[model samples]
Target: MALRTLFADPMLRMLVAAVLLAALLPARGEARDTAQLVANAAVFLLFLLNGLRIARRDVLAGLANWRFLLPLILFVFGAMALLGLGLNALSEPLLPPAIALGFLYLGALPSTVQSATSYASLGGGNLALSVVSAALLNIVGVFVTVPVFLLLGGSGQGAVGSAVIAKILLLLVLPFVIGQALQTAAHSFTARYRHNIVWVDRMAIAIAVYVAFSGAVEQGIWTRVAPQAWAALLGLVAVMLLLAHGGAWLTGGMLGLPRADRVSFLFAGAQKSAAVGAPLATILFAPEAAGFIVVPLLLYHLIQLVVAAPLASRLAQHPAGDGDCTAPTTTATDRSAPPR
Candidate 1:
């Protein structure tokens, strides 16, 4: 019953299982190369589905809330920046330099879409706001995160250039555009079939996680990370989540956002995107070091879900005050239908 309850969230079950599977029986030789290709294709398809589902009007509605949006963005990006810098300063003693860089990399990532909105909706937050905020952050993240990464990473200027941006455009942006165009062409079909269509994104994420973890295992990633470091990373993840949620709550109060809007702000601004982070890490870090860089992200992903699950349940008990949330949004009922 306990295990069943824990696995109730398909996202959590799949991600945790993928990591364990990769750790125990990593792909090798030709299989490894093949897996990487599959992961890449899956990522592209995932974004393509994203394009198909996200309505432009929803984004526009979110954009209208400039006062609420601006400070939220600053809190998400700026606060993470400060946290990453502090972690970087202290992590050298606790973690490998490359892994330390991973925490910084994790900090620079955009907010999650599927998971964040799911939790926000569950928690009686402004689901539309969560969706739009997540969409906007990712769109900007492709351009902004690279520079933030390079600036925070403080190394390998040559690693990031137009080529990396080109990859993001090709792999992430193009498919989304095609999907969006398709949505425009067939709005009814897209809406009717979204539940079925979301499998593509979920599969893509699973494959990507498998491939990333497999590669890391092959590179002795587990051997390099001591038990203490793992414990520290876990603790750090908890602390980060707490600080992010608390900070967002406080910011929302200061901005005088309504309860529902505050809930959206807290949930959406606090979570990071593992889906985008995995593929981007492959491009940014050395192949051998990529796994270590992903470690913090993986931990962050799992920890957020664990922390937010009960919080969402608790928040749901309160009455969600209606405010100015008019945009169409996703909810837990359509788990497999939205892009993350």
Candidate 2:
């Protein structure tokens, strides 16, 4: 049994951490605030590494597949906007309608580096595509999500904070482009030192945790968000998860994509990139509303990780879990195994 768990696939861990983090979010205090700070920093580092590893040509290639990935991202964003509208109408006592709705905004942002690639690896897909997809979203989200945020959220000038644009450009976008450049120039170094580069991933996660949790406590996250509200958020996460995963799988499959592509779609389509997106909120919105934007991202992150991991393991066993429609496949393609 010990060996089984030790050998157990890593993909499931994402879902576990997602639910756990939401459950563990700091409730309006210093501790939470401190944690939030750490988390922010951690995510930043991860973004840099993600940027550094990107291959320029791959990103260009992803542009070619825009018809496939872009529409899915838009659909997620649109659904979030519409969901926000509903939550706004309901206007529950617990629901800070704007914030509750903003959670939907968080949902729409897009998938991230660590988990998306990690899950792709678990599900036995294309790691290169996973990296490109995540990097593209981080770059494009600067323009796409921020505007949608303002539109759906209505001039949240002070809602998140000041550095939204800069942070996205610098921490997220700039690093990715730079990384791609580095990938080309330092091809030998990156290949030689790939193992060492993962330290960057861990550092980013640590910083994100400190910053997010700390801020939650410093601000009135507990009073504002509340337990019941969290419950509602969890329910919303499950629904979104189903939709994103199902939508991607069905759509990709219908397009006659091979199993490798389908696996990539399911993981990428379903998961949100909290690591990248959460810190972006800190830069964009108010300290108070930071928790709100991040809440959805966090929930989505955990759910996808835990859920994606198991599904990945299962799919690994069955390969074509899709049944009679099962297609014989070649060797595993893009498997994203990020740092433990």
Candidate 3:
């Protein structure tokens, strides 16, 4: 049943397909250039839709809950990022430098708005808070991830300079700002067709992955990375997952959060956003290096989904309440829709 649930995710299947397709027939020369351009456009559209969908009121609500939000931000970007640095140092001897650096990249990423909220809902968490917190984390991620990555010593083949900052502002931040500005006019349309629009997110991520992996393949990634290195990488990722989930849960308890909020924190603090990570990698790294840098994130995303399903099921069954572990009630106007 767990295996079925995992495979049933279309986004997951799309990502796997993207990786396999890149391996079998990676774009090169003119094709590579064309694919990169398409990926860029897709990323812009994706962020624009995010800005349209995330209500300003929700942002304010999340901000108002600073006690909950502050810790979460610190955990996702601070403690987790430091953990990534440790993992990178440990894995340096075992894996290639770029792939090892992926640990820090993964650590620095934001929580997944979709998966975190979905699983939080499934686990009988505070759905309203889950949606708002995860959305805000993504918003914060766009601004903070690059600086955090660089501060923690993450750099790709391409130098991060004025050009890169301009690209991020133009392709990512600017589009989101445009969406926010147009939100009053487009909110109804975005709300009405959100489920359909999830495809845009998935497709953008897939395209970015395909492009990054294509360059890696062109550079002979398979030959450069050894089988033993793959095993070491998986082992390291598992350790990081355990720490992420356990640490979040423990922190929530230490802070005396209600069970429902704890559930929300568990998922929100632990999961990383491939939606943000993949596209941002393309912007930050050269194509060949971006592929290796994203490898850890891709693997972590898959494993988290598999783990979250069963964990959520378990939590749902044992709603040992400091209060009922069901989603909090909120009106449509006040509630923020979780992004896919």
Candidate 4:
């Protein structure tokens, strides 16, 4: 039954298919160049859609809830990054250099806007706050993740030069700004067709993964990484997952937040965005390097989805009080378009 539920997820299936495809037939020579171009364009479209879909008022509202937002930002970027660094140190002897660095990259990322919000809603959390907080974290992550990763020694894979910085601004930040500027004109279109457009996000991520893994295959990832290293990597990722979710929940309780708000914090603080992580990796590292760097993130993403479903179900069944049952009003737009 649990296996059925896990396989039922289309995103998980797609991601698995992507990894298998990359291993079986990796792009090389000119094909690799073409694939990279397509991946970049897909990333641009993904973030542009994010800008068009997310409501401006929600950003303002989320920012005003500093009590929630400040703590969440710190937890996601600060504590989590440190946790990743600590784990990376432990993983160095067990895994390859690039793959070990993946832990730090994973921690530096933002929360998933779609899955986090979806789970928060399922768990009977403050849906409005969930939407705003997750979206805001992604927004902040676009700017902050690189610096945080670099500061924490992620640059050991490759230096983030000015050219890469320009690409980041052009490929990511500019598209989002343009989309936001055009949002007023496209609001109805975005709201009406959001579910369909979410495929853009998924496709972009899959393309990034495919491109990245293709490079890894080309560089002999299969032979370089031993079977025992794979086991160690999985064990390390599991530990990180436990810490992320457990720590977030405990911190929320410490903050004295209502149960609903605590649920929101749990998902928002714990979840990491492959939407942001995958595309950014392509720009940051060579394809060969990126494939290894994103291995931890890919595993973490799949595991989190599997864990969130049952955890959400349990939370729903055992609501703490009136606070857990209350549903705050949110814009239709906020609920409609969530970045995966």
Residue range 50-168, candidate 4, lDDT tens digits: 99988899999999999999999999999999999999999999999999999999999999987899889988899999999999999999999999999998898965899999999
lDDT for 4 (candidate 2):
38
Candidate 4 TM-score over all chains jointly: 0.93
lDDT of 2 at 203: 46
What are the models' TM-scores?
0.87, 0.73, 0.93, 0.93
The alpha-carbon lDDT assigned to residue 206 of candidate 2 equals: 39
TM-score of 3: 0.93
Error of 3 at 5 (Å): 1.3
Give the 10-residue window scoring lowest on summed lDDT in candidate 1: 330-339
Task: Kindly report which residue stretches of model 2 are placed more than 4 angstroms away from their true locations once superposed.
Answer: 1-45, 76-93, 97-99, 124-128, 154-163, 223-226, 318-340
lDDT of 1 by residue, 106-184 (tens): 7778888878888889878888788898888876676677778777754541256677678778888898889877878
lDDT of 2 at 162: 56
Is 3 or 4 the stronger prediction by lDDT?
3
lDDT of model 3, residue 7: 71
Error of 1 at 91 (Å): 1.5
lDDT of each: 0.74, 0.60, 0.89, 0.88
- Tell me the TM-score of model 2: 0.73
